[model samples]
Structure formats: structure tokens, C-alpha cells
Target: MAVQGIVTAADRIRELDEINGGLADMLNHMGQAIKALGPNAQAGSDDLDARKEVFQEHSRAAYVCTQAFHARMKRQVYALEEAGIILAQAHIHSATSSAKHKQANNQPVQGQGGAPPVPPASEAEHITNGGLGNLDVGWLNSRGNKVGMEKEAELLQEAKILLEDELERRRGPAASAG
Candidate 1:
């Protein structure tokens, strides 16, 4: 029964490892696709109005892609931690079972206890970041700030001003006469 339990935990750890690998591959593909967009990874145009629209579109695409990548990476980190815990428990269980079998056979056990040492409270803090320890929170906040309708409106306003100026220049005295 103990062997079966250990096998199950090992299988779970392997599955999680495979999932992490697949997620990494997926993230790499996403990065490649973003790079393929162009040198700027943004939309470009010669005209102000068109360029504004393209910029908004590009921003939305980039924001969505980045969010997805971050989410997946977070999940991967969580899965890795779960796998580690499972493997650790399996080890502890195997050690305890062996100690019990040795005692039953009147053999001396080697370790003081069949359990692992307790980690310090500081170590708990290290894992309590909710799998976001490696993430750049400030950068994400700045990116979030750049998203949504407000930024689009600001870009449109700038484009409108430029278009009006160009129109006035083209009209010259005719615009005032009309």
C-alpha cells in the first residue's frame, strides 16, 4: 500500500513536470509571434489617424498577450511547487515505512526520526508570494495603466489635433473666407 502511494505521488509529479514544460513552450511560441509582428512589435503607418488606430490595436494585442503569458507562468510556478511538495511527502512516507519495517524485523533504524526537518518561518515567507515572486509587479501595473479606453481616447485626441492643423494649413486663406 505504501509503495502504491509513492507511485501515485511520483506519477503526479511527472505529470506536473510535463505541464510546466508545455507551458514554457507555449510561452516561447507566444513571444515569437509577438516578435514576428515587426521590429517595433507595434502597428505602423504614414498617416496620423491610421497610425493612431493601429497603435491602439497593437497595444490591445500586446496587453492581452502579456496578461496571458503572465497567467500561464504563474500557473506553472504553482504546479512546480505542488510537485515538489508531493515528492517531499513521498520521500517522508517511504522513509517512515522503511523505519517501521526495520523495527518489526528487530533491526536498528539509522535516522533519529523518519520525518523531514521543519523548515524555518522565513522559508515560508519565501513561498508565500503566490507564485509571483519572479514577476515584476511594478511593470505589470504600468502596463495595466496604459490599457483601456482612456488611452485610446487620448491617442485619438492627439490625432484629431494634428489632422485639424494639417487641414488648416492646406486651406490657407480659403478656410477663413468660407
Candidate 2:
């Protein structure tokens, strides 16, 4: 747990450093863009260069810090991953041991004299209205009031009749016998 905490802290620090480095890069780009646009840009090359050098120094420092943080955090992550594997194996071993222990205990337990309790029955109930009491399959094909869907319902009914006629034509006894 302590190691996990340490690893978590290291991970956070690495993430923060990475974020800081990105922000620094963005700032550097903005600074260069501004210097490029301003009228006295060429005349102030020396001053701009000095400012650029300072920025470079800071950027390099940030990069070095991020790299170091990553290296350290990577080790911690590796250790944490290893610990997880070890912990999983330990749990498996403990579970098996517990199962054996339980079996040993249950040999005498033999529940109340002869056997364990039986489970209850599960009946699958039928539904109506599509579901209990609301089983309205009127919506199976559509949802429209008798007034509002008159045209659409007529078209659908005609379509269903057409489908039935087509199906019967294709599946008639003479068609199948051939």
C-alpha cells in the first residue's frame, strides 16, 4: 500500500511535469510568433536572441526534469505492476487453500443432519399487452391514432396484403411440389 502510494505520487509528478513541459513549449511558440510580427523585430534581434536564450535554457531544464521524472516513475510503475501480479497469485493460492479448508469443514457440517437446503422454483410468467396487462401489440407494426394514421395505416395494410399474396404465390402447393 505504501509502495502504491509512492507509485501514485510519482505518476502524478510525472504527469504534472509533462503538462508543464507542454505549456512551456506553447509559451515559447507564442513568444516567437509575437516577436516575428512586431515591427522592431529585426532591429531588436539581439534583445530577442537574449530572451530566446533564456527561454531555451528554461525549456532544456524542463525537458531534463520531465525525463528524470519519467524514468523514476517508470520504475515505480514496473514495481507496481509486478506487485499486482504477485498479489493476484497470492489471492489464487489463498482461495484454493480456503476452498480446501471449507471442504474439510463441510465434511462434518453436513447441514442439519442430512443435506443442504434446496433452491426455490423459478416460473417464467407470460405477458400480455406486449407485457403484463399492457400487452398492446397494436404498436408491433406502428403507433398511430385511428384518426392521425389513417392514410399511413391504409398504406401499411395494403402493403401487408401485398406481402401475403406474394408469399402465398411463392409458397403455394404447386410451387413447392415442383
Candidate 3:
């Protein structure tokens, strides 16, 4: 959903760019006409008025597109927030389950020898220690809970790239100049 929202926002941004280009062309043509005809010239004034009306239409369209882009961005943000919440919940569930498993294993069962309970290693420790690569994710696959996580990661990466491209485009030549 976030990826789709980014795409929708990007499309709206492109529409705004095209509309702005048309508006700029109209302004340039109007300026050239006025300069060529002088302020008092009435020839083709009706055409100029029609062009002004078209420019206004383009401006209104651009405004609507801008609003749409803003809405899509908000939706993307909401989607991301929801995804974060879900991931956090999953993490907490995993931690709780791991703790329970460790506790159960540490208990002395009937007929078991009275040896000291060995401290069980935890997946959460690996996660907290920043060892995501070492973190056990097979449990997720077995439970069918994170089957689409890889695809989600890819979509998020694409969204990030799209956003970066849009930001760079908005920055324009000034970013390169600096």
C-alpha cells in the first residue's frame, strides 16, 4: 500500500510538473505578445484572454494534483506506521515465546538427573546485539507469519528509491551546485 501510494504521489507530481510547464509556456507567450504589440494594441486580445483562461484552468488542475499528492503522502506515512506497529508486535511475540520455551526447558522434569540447568541462548539476544543475519527467521516461515516480509522489504526499498528520486528532482540544480 505504501509503495502504491508513493507511485500515486509520484504520478501526481509529474502531472503538476507538466501543468507548470504549460503555464510557464503560456506566460512566456503572453509576455512576448504584449511586448510585440505594445500595451495599447487590441489585436488578438481575445486569443490572449482565452489563453489566460486556459492558464487559470491549468493552475486549478495543478492545485488539485498537489492536494492529491499530499493525501497520498499521508497515506504512505500511515501505512509505514502500521507496518512498524505490526513488526514490533511480531518481535514482542517472538521474544515472549522464546522466553517461555527457555523457561520450560530449564525446569527439571521427572526422572531427569539433578544437574544444573544450563542457561539457554536466546534469539532476542542476537537481535539486540545487532546480529540480524544470525537471527532465526525460520520460525516465522514455519508459522506462515512472515512469508511476505521479503517482498515487503523489496517494496519498501523501491519506495525509498522513488522518494529519493523525487527529493533530488525537487532540489533541482541547486543541489548539484552546492
Candidate 4:
């Protein structure tokens, strides 16, 4: 059981790493797209030039905000990955300790005994109880965490809403032109 927990945590960490990589790639693409727009105005008239300036300012601001957001998200993802590592280590340590304790008494490694050794508090619990930093790995895996299902659902809903809003904004100009 403890081994299974460790495996599961390892798998989750891999998944999160993949997700973080994809997000970083997306941020890089966004930055490249913004840069490709060029800073100099290509408008022919004074009024158009002024409008282009305003548009450039807004685009720069948005790009900066997005970069900041991406940086923060990356940090959070790294922290979560670190937490998973810690949890997996703890599981392995616990299992090893249990085996050693049983061996000293000449007991079977996996058989009815005086009860199994207590495992360390889960990674989610460690974070929640303030043993570690303030991160919600429970949302990633609620196996042993005290997190409510609703919280995870709410997070997914929020992400969906943000994506939908971005899609709508992107389509607005095209729809108006048509």
C-alpha cells in the first residue's frame, strides 16, 4: 500500500512537469507573437498613428501582465513538484523503517503482526497542517488529503471560464468585421 502511494505520487509529479512544460512553451509563443507585432506604428495618418500608439501601449501592458502571471504559475508548479518529491521520499522511508522493524523481530515482511507501522502524514496533510509551505497539492491528488471534491471542481470551472472569455475576446473583432 505504501509503495503504491509512492508510485502514484511519482506519476502525478511527472504529469505536473509535463503540464508546466506545455505552459512554459505557450508563454514563450505568446511572447514571440507580441514581439512579432513590432513596436513602430505603420499607420499612414496622424489619427491612425495615435490609435496605433494606444494599441501598442495596451498590448505591452497585457504582455507584461501575462508574463508575470506565467512566472507565478511556474513557481507554484515547481513548488508542487518539490512537495511530491518530499512525499515520495517520506513514503519510501516509512516503508524501509517498517521492514527493518519487522526484520529485527523475525516477522514476515507482509503478514498479520501487531499492526503495521504508522505512515507519515500525507503530502497534502503536511502542506495543509503547515508542516511545509502553503501549497494545495490536494487539488492534484485527493487520495489521502482532506480536500473537498468541490474545491477541485471549482478550480476546473474557473479555468474553463477564463478560456471561454479569451476565446470570446479573440472572436469579437472578427465577428464585428463580418
Candidate 5:
């Protein structure tokens, strides 16, 4: 789904570029047309002058609007990145809980020959290791030291509760802010 979102964003950027290019071409042609009229006091020249002013205003407005659009697109990309991170964390928490639960129940994890199951590598690992390194999850411990294992299930549950609360609040009728 994230990949789809990224591809859509890329397509939209290409479209925006094409639109801006077309606008530039149109503005350039308009400028050339105005210059072809060449500073004459002939009739309809005043009308051309008025058209030139309107074109300039339109060009300015298009440029300003495109700049604002680019800013918004940047913010959207940042938001998507954040959402991906949060989802990844939640996934890790879920996987860790499943592994621990299975271990506690003395059940043979799937395809593990009765050994304890390991949590999957996290997004941070993929980013830092270039997709080829140890699969240890390095969550922070209570003293701020990095621990190469799963976080406590209680902490993960607490975070889940908080996120659920936030989601519920957002879905409330009186919700006016994120």
C-alpha cells in the first residue's frame, strides 16, 4: 500500500511538471506574440497591452500556486513516512507478542523445530543495514541503552492503548484537530 502511494505521488509529480511546462510554453508564446506587436500606437495595441498585463498576472498566480502545491506535497510525503514508521512499529510489537506467547505456551513455532521464534527485522534495521545484517531488534531499554531484543510486552501494550485512544478521539464527533 505504501508502494502504491509512492507510485501515485510520483505520477502526480510528473503531471504537475508537465502542467508547469505547458504553462511556461504558453506564457512564452504570449510574450513573443506581445513583442511581435512591437511598441506601436496602432489600434487594438491597447487591447494587446491589457492582455499582456493579464497574462503576467496569470503567470505570477500559477507560479505561486505551484510553489504552494510543492510545499503541500512535501508535507504529505513526510506524513506518509511517519505513518509507515508507526505501522511498522505496531507490526513489530504484534510479532513480538506472538512469539513470546507461543514460547510461554510451550508450542513449537512454525518451521522452527521447537526453538523460540525471533521477531522479524524492523524498518530501522533495513535502513541501517542496507537489507543485509543481523536481524536483532534494537529497542531502547529503561536507562536509554540499546538492547538487542524485543521491548517488554507491557510497554508495547501501553503504546497500543495510547494509539487506540488517539484514534478514538479523532473519530469523535467533536474532533476538531488531529
Candidate 6:
């Protein structure tokens, strides 16, 4: 009876570990995908309107991807919590069995003989302590985002300068009186 419970809990723990690994892999891939976006977007005046449209579309797509990643990560966290619970139960079972084993040898059930160990905090506890947003860029207003944001602003400034230069280069002479 108790043995079966122990086995079930162990199995649950292993499954959760696997899920966590897969989730980490997905998060890594998403990071790489976001990085695949090119840099130095300095389109000429002729293409300014087109470049603006492209930037807007990229922002929208990034938003959707960010949301999807958040949801998947949340599910992974929940799975980790579930696994922690199963592991705690397994620890209890092991302790109880040890107590039974001790008693069979005419020893006291814990205290007078040996005490069962308490389960340590789950790794999830360490992770959840610092919620999200370390790397998430969904909330642009966050001061934590200033680092890369400053660089982005600089890039945009350069693009604007390039557009002005292109405009000047393409400008024609003003028309005179007929």
C-alpha cells in the first residue's frame, strides 16, 4: 500500500523534471528567435513609410509571441508545484516506513529511537521567489528595460538622421514663377 504510494510520487517527480527541461528548451528557443530580428534599420526616405510599417508589424508579432511564452511558462511552473507536492508525500512515506522498520526491531517509533527527516524546500520555491520579468520585454515602461531600450532609441535616432539625409539627397529645386 505505502510502497505503491511512494512509487507513484517518484514517478510524478520524474515526469515534472522532464517537463521542466522541455520548458527551458522552449524558452531558450524563443530568446533565439527574438534575437534573429535584424539590427540597424536605417531606411531611406523613399522607404521610410515602408520601414515604419515593417517595424509596427514586428512589434505586434513580438507581443503575441511574448504572451504565448508567458502562458507556457506559467503552466510549467504549475507542473513544478505539483511535482513538489508529490515529492513531499513520498518523503513522508519513506519516513513512515523507516519508523515501522525500527519498531519491528523493538525500537521506539521516532523520538526515543530515530526521527524522520523533513523534506527540503523544492527548487520551485527558489524560482518563484523572484517572480517574472528578469528578461521579459512585454512591459516597455519598466526601468529595468532601459539598457537595451537606450540602444534602440539610439538606433532609431540614427535611422531618422539617415531618412533626413536621404530626403535632402532626393529633394528637387523649388519651382519659379512662369
Query: For residues 1-178, what per-residue lDDT tens digits would candidate 6 score against the true structure?
Result: 2374354656656656765665566565555445434443443344555555665665565566566657766665555546552222222235676566656667565654345532234623533213341324455356576778899999999999999988776664433322
Q: What is the C-alpha lDDT profile of model 1 across 33-103, one tens digit per residue?
A: 55544444444434555545555565566566567667766565555556553221222224466567667
Residues 124-147 of candidate 3 have per-residue lDDT tens digits of 443331332323466556878464
- The candidate that wins on TM-score is 1
Per-residue C-alpha lDDT of model 2 across residues 1-178, encoded as one tens digit per residue: 2364454655656766776676666566556655555555555564766656655665565566556656756565555446542221222123344445547656432335665422111211322222223323555436646665787889999999999999899789877799
lDDT of 3 at 77: 49
**Per-residue CA lDDT of candidate 4, range 1-178, in tens?**
2374354555656756865665666566555545445544344444655655555665565566567667766655565656653332222335577677668877666645656554334533443323334445664575654466677988999999999999999999999999
Q: Estimate each model's TM-score.
A: 0.28, 0.25, 0.25, 0.26, 0.25, 0.27
Show the colliding residue pairs in model 3: none
lDDT of each: 0.56, 0.53, 0.54, 0.58, 0.55, 0.54
RMSD of each: 25.6, 22.8, 25.7, 23.4, 23.1, 26.2
* Candidate 3 lDDT trough over 10 residues, lowest sum: 84-93
Those runs of model 1 whose alpha carbons end farther than 4 Å from true positions after fitting are: 1-45, 85-178
Superposition TM-score, candidate 4 onto the true structure? 0.26
Q: After superposition, how far is residue 96 of candidate 2 from its true place, in Å?
A: 41
**Model 5 C-alpha lDDT per residue in residues 8-104, reported as the tens digit of each score:** 6566567668666766765665555555455542344667666566656656665665676577565654554554532222333345675666578
Model 5: runs farther than 4 Å from truth?
1-46, 85-178
Q: In terms of TM-score, which candidate is stronger, 1 or 3?
A: 1
